[model samples]
Target: MAVLLHLDSSLFPLENSGSRQLTDAFRRTWQEAHPQGSVIYRDLAADRVPHLDAATVAADTLPPLRRQLIAEFEKADVVLIGAPMYNFTVPSTLKAWLDQIILAGRTFGEGVPASGKRVVVASSRGGSYRPGTPRAGFEFDTNYLEKVLGDALGLRVEVITRELTLAPVTPAMAALIPQAEESARQSLLRAAESAREHAALVS
Candidate 1:
């Protein structure tokens, strides 16, 4: 059976988190498409991986947790990540998880074990970051992931972005609330569509 590794890094709960909703939509669609597939889920905010340390880097042997994380990543047929931008970048917990699994000689370097695997990232940010937007240059979350997960690790990276998420709560962003809602709706649709498309390739 196919295996999906899902990682959620949103700090807020489902009801309040746009990234969670997008990822959940993808997961649900994926489940429907692969009735017997297995899902491995991690809520990074609640169970954060330790940041990489000197001991992990200098040790003669791989740390147990790092080994396990790598194994899990290699086992996955697909990876779904809910990455809500915090301070113009990915959550620290997500970064920690990346540090654990990105083994140079294994998952990254020559003969990359994760090559060709599909990773759909549900990326949500408070403001617009598309090209031509005023804050486009400030976008580091999805762009960083594309480089690390795709260019470096060789995973096939696909991102569904939900922007202007702060519009609902910030008084100054009130005028963009409609755009935020539309962005969210489109993100959910894109997530489901992408999940089904990827699921068809699992077998």
Candidate 2:
């Protein structure tokens, strides 16, 4: 059976954040499309993966830790990440999780080697940062994820952003919430479809 790795970094679960809801919706759609597939879930909030520290950095270079994480990464064909942008970047928890998975020679190597993996990042933010918008400068989180996962790790990457714009709610911000949520849901569905197609091609 195909494997789908699900990583949820939202502190609020599905109750408070539009991002989690969007991810959940995507999960359901993906499950429907690939009924025989199995999902492995990693909840970063409840079971936090430690950030790369002195110990972890050292461990990463060692053969044991490198083999362990690489084994995990190799087992999954599809990776689904539910992340919330914090202060114009990925949440520290998600970054920590990424640190563990990104082994220089394991996930990638010289000559642009491909891992033949697919990753979907579902992110939520409180502002509008789409390109061409004035606030687009705040898009470091999504961009960084794409660059790191795709270029560095050699995983095909897709992103779905859920703009809350509801917190710190000004009248203008409040007006965009409904449309933004709808857009996010649609994007997530599209990502799910893409994942299904990619999984089929790989299988």
Instruction: Assess every candidate by TM-score.
Output: 0.97, 0.85
Model 1 misplacement above 4 A = 111-114
Candidates in order have lDDT scores of: 0.94, 0.76
Quick one: best TM-score, which candidate? 1
TM-score of 1: 0.97
Model 2 off-target regions past 4 Å?
A: 59-68, 165-172, 195-199
- lDDT, model 2, position 203: 54
Pairs with backbone N, CA or C atoms under 3 Å apart (clashes), candidate 2: none
